[model samples]
Target: MDDVAGIFARESPYLERYVQLGIASGRVLSVSFPDAPDEDAEVDHELLDRIFDYLSGVEDDFSDVEIALTVPTDQRRALDRVREIPYGDQINVETLARMTSGIDHTDEDDLNTVRTALDQNPAPLLIPDHRVRDGPSAAPPAIEQKLRSLEGL
Candidate 1:
């Protein structure tokens, strides 16, 4: 298994905040809110810039940034649909469950699958899990709301 062997931190567009990324094999594996910047960690300048851009309301949907996720097949399917949600747009959980799981109607089990997939999203901003209305993400509520506000949602 690949471990998060690289760490990078940068000043976030969010006031008085810094964002840290855990990277491995040239793909970002996680994002976190840290109180201070790390000057010693290796830097992936390009990816950090993209994250800053996204936080700055630059309107890039993060399609260019690569993220690594390990999840069950059902969860992967739901996340794939979540990734396609554009910046500043939102989708209801019911609709997303149908679109991703291919259920003819809104089923509780399917909705739970989508919810669980979102709740377990390893990378939030890169995957845009918050774009799904009432969607749960690993990101803190403040951060998710901040991201949504940044996107003008």
Candidate 2:
């Protein structure tokens, strides 16, 4: 997974780990959007185009590729606000809705909002469940002793 931000590739610690694992295991291509707001009306067509271009270049390495979009919980309200916008030719409402509502899995309000967005845009959106990585197997004895001493203070 290559993270392209504003037409330039960027580094993300979390994505680096994920991509490293995926590439090593020869898993399907999975691209994620970690910090993009849900209601971002302009879908960053340039970024998407670049991503697709990159994907096309790598088509031979992986047989299948998928896109995963992540949005913060706070961005739902912004999506609601987007619905009220005039949404001139500058934006694609369907794509915006799909990207925004892709990972909404909270309560009735969120579900309804997601449903509405999906109803408006029936494309399948990838929503990844947050997975916690296991920490180090064991700490050095000296480090453990230091931690124990600190706990007693």
Candidate 3:
């Protein structure tokens, strides 16, 4: 597997934040925070539409949208668990660690591993890392909070 940091640095460009009225279920897809440099970058119309719909209200489902997030193989299980987190709910690190404990055939989902998986999550809303929090140290805290507020949770 590739190094997580290297993957993030290389794949940063593809990560986009966009919103479309009737396109993506009124959801927003962003790689970073609104104020980040990549915020104003151009994105595909279809993708924006999907993001809009996904973030809209209750009809957002991105199972059809194909996205690639590169991380260590061990983290895949935890990331999948992160994605499984409901749109309007959040989970703490300990809980996530417990949930994903046996996924990798070992206790690889310790606190630090889970934290790294979340912090390096390439797709935020798609994976919904904002829903996982353990205090001010959660990955992408500001963006996570914004997403949670958007969901009215």
Best by TM-score: 1
**C-alpha displacement of 66 in model 3, angstroms?**
2.5
lDDT of 2 by residue, 10-80 (tens): 33232231111111122212333334332322343333443344333321211133322134443443234
Q: Report the lDDT tens digits of candidate 3 across residue range 1-153.
A: 121111111112222332211112233323444433333344445545555555555456455544454577656778777767776777887788778845432454466787788777766667777777662323355546656777776
Query: Ten consecutive residues with minimal summed lDDT in candidate 3?
Result: 1-10
Would you give me the overall lDDT of model 3?
0.54
Worst 10 residues of 1 by lDDT: 98-107
Q: 1-153 in candidate 1: lDDT tens per residue? A: 144467888776584567778888778778776677666666556777887876666778777667777888888888888889988899988878777756433578778888888888888888888898787877878888888878778
In model 1, where do residues sit more than 4 Å from their true spots?
1-5, 13-15, 36-40, 102-105
For model 2, name the residue pairs that clash. Answer: none
TM-score of 1: 0.85
Ranking by TM-score: 1, 3, 2
TM agreement with the true structure for every prediction: 0.85, 0.18, 0.63
Clash total of candidate 1:
0
Model 3 regions lying over 4 Å from their true place: 1-30, 34-43, 101-109, 135-140
What are the per-model C-alpha RMSD values against the true structure?
3.2, 18.1, 8.7
The C-alpha lDDT values of all candidates are 0.77, 0.29, 0.54
Best by lDDT: 1
Q: What is the lDDT of residue 115 in candidate 1?
A: 89
lDDT of 3 at 25: 28
